[model samples]
Target: MTATGTTLVIGATGTTGSRTAARLMAGGHRVKAASRRATSIPGAEPVLFDWYDPATHAAALDGVDRVYLIPPVGESDPAVVMLPFLHRARTAGVQRAVLLSSSAIPEGGPAVGTVHQALPDLFQQWAVLRPSWFMQNFTDTHAHALSIREDGIIWTATDSGRVGFVDAEDIAAVAVHALTDEHAPNTDLVLTGPEALSYDDVATILTEVTGRPVVHRKLSYEQLRDRLTALVPVEFAAILAGLDRAIAEGAEDRLTDTVQRLIGRPARTLRALCEREMR
Candidate 1:
């Protein structure tokens, strides 16, 4: 028998997925936090669901009627890994899917674009949330924090282009509304913060907030990739730098009202995000 009320939240321990699960739980919805390990988080039961292992797939899909699909991280071809899971979800009689996709990549780009192509035929209802670069890059994650503590510098290939730097919390809120409501807009939604700001703007804000000197160092794509290789794999670093090049070329410079449209409120501003996030 299909699980009537539970929503399977893939990558539920991640930045966006964790927030999505919490919001779902707060709304009194049953949530299964699906991850590679049976790790526990607040507001949800843990379930083992690895993208690499199909053996763990069925148990995760079992009884769940809806899913929040997070693409495998650092994979060159995430769609290859996720398509089978989507097929399984369809076979399991899952009704709706909310896909967490990238704003940098277009609908048919190299990343989750394949899922964008396949999901329409597989699921009865779907919504894709394409959000701009997260403001949390400077606050929560290891790399950004390490940058702050050690060098007091932020580096990127964004050049002078401004991003609307949406908050992950806002993205999660939209995902919760999309997954729970039957009337969710059945199309790709590009979500961004209310104002557009450059890396310089971000660094200035961080400096002001933390009472320290924080600088934005503009690096060439190649230089950025080389530097990131010291922290992450060279291949992943290349991909990230390429996306930053896309930003530098003005791909992610525009702002959208998707967050406000979906959540009925203005998206969080970068300064506001920093005020709360920076310590």
Candidate 2:
């Protein structure tokens, strides 16, 4: 893609999208940062874009050849709301797409997976990033971080389940490569960190890094669902709980070298990520 062609970043204020936008800007590529509220990034053009609103889609896709897709959050079935916009993007001459999907959600599965499966058919140059559970979940203002800060606890239903939790920064680096490189990986890249770790390991890492008594509190699926329902819809809460259940069943117990292979460096370790974020 030409350096002059604008790369539209959906959910530009989000974890991976924001970092990808920054990386693109640093590389001297044109970036259009799109979100619901027009938030500005230093070297990006901010555009208002909403999934439910088709009017916002054309304006966001205008003069754009590449896009970083961040699926709608908190929605059980995001494809229903996003596919139309993606079609619009293609119609508007967008040639490349990089979708941010989860490790647990396989291609053709519900949610982002549906979009992942559809991308190859929609665009000639496309890549799907299926990253493991994000390390930011424990450091940012997410539920895990909030619980750790407020009560010194990391609660989850994935008892003793180990995951190759990846850093959002690494994910973004790979995403930038996918978006700009001439020979982008035309297949889904399952990204993970250097090691597989459980929540207990994460708690220990947190305690050591922050010098605080952080503990992992494992809850039953029912209890976890109940706790999440207060914050999200019951259906979404159940889906979250179901993911925990899948983890407990050893679904996420694996690691991959995709990040290192693609980015020419090893993936970041959880300890390293915690040490950096804690400071």
Candidate 3:
């Protein structure tokens, strides 16, 4: 990114993307906040963008050199939409791209990981952010919070798997650095918090913060599948449950120093995150 080049954030309304947009503006960099609604963000430019709608792609990419790419939510597959968008962004003269990927999804595997495999060759400079479970999944999102508030029990198949949940703010800070730095990192970063904790640990923290009884109850895969099917399609529900099973197998149970390495501070602790949001 140059001093005068534009930085486009694809999911500007989302938790991490919004923070990334704000950080870019604070650094005196040009930013374009793009979302489906064209919502304006403070200290940045606004533009309409939608992953499902290809027609809005060009206008959003107009005069943009750097991009923060976010895969659309709840769509198990994203390569179909991302591939074309990458080609179009190259044509529109995008020089770098910072993709928000997942820790659970391996590079060149399922979901957005497939998109990660193809991004390097499409742009001049690119970086992939593969952060572990987001801390916002509990506090900022309605689904997890509602479950804790209404049910008094958090249900998942992960019995004792630990996760180093990374704060969205930390993720955003790294993104800002990647987008505006003289040279892009051009590597796949696996980010995590300073400490790893299980869901039971999270429940204990919630119970302490909220002064309410919240229990982490392990559910069988079939039970979780049935519960999710009521809210989403069966296949999608299976995918969600499969993630829990993966976690149970110790898939995302490690801590990483990428956050501190990139942003000069240790990743936010889960206890701090819970106290800030749940309390």
| Candidate 3 weakest lDDT stretch, 10 residues | 137-146
The TM-score of candidate 1 is 0.95
Name model 1 segments beyond 4 Å from true. Answer: 1-4
Show how many residue pairs clash in every candidate, following the order shown. Answer: 1, 0, 0
lDDT digits (tens) for residues 59-171 of candidate 1: 89888888998999878789888998899889997888999988887778877887887777787788888989888888887576679768999888889988889899999
Q: Is candidate 1 or candidate 2 better by lDDT?
A: 2
lDDT of 3 by residue, 1-279 (tens): 447489999999898899999888888888889999999888878999999999999999999998999998777789998899999999999999999998988889888989999988887688999999888888876567778878878888998988888999999998987888888888889989898889999999888888998899899888998999988878779988999998899999888889898889888987888888777
For each candidate in the order shown, give its overall lDDT on alpha carbons: 0.86, 0.92, 0.88
Model 1, residue pairs in steric clash:
3-63
CA error at residue 151 for candidate 2, angstroms: 0.6
Off by over 4 Å in 3: 1-4
Q: After superposition, how far is residue 150 of candidate 1 from its true place, in Å?
A: 2.2
Cα RMSD (Å) per model? 2.3, 1.1, 1.4
By TM-score, who's the top model here? 2
Tens digit per residue, CA lDDT, model 2, 1-279 = 335478999999998999899988998999999999979889899999998888888888989998999988889999898888889889999999999999999999977888898999999999999999999999997999999999999999999999999999999999999999987678999999999999999999999999999999999999999999999999899999999988999999999999999889999998999889886
The alpha-carbon deviation from the true structure for residue 24 of candidate 3, after best TM-score superposition, in angstroms, is: 1.0
For model 3 the local lDDT of residue 148 reads 87
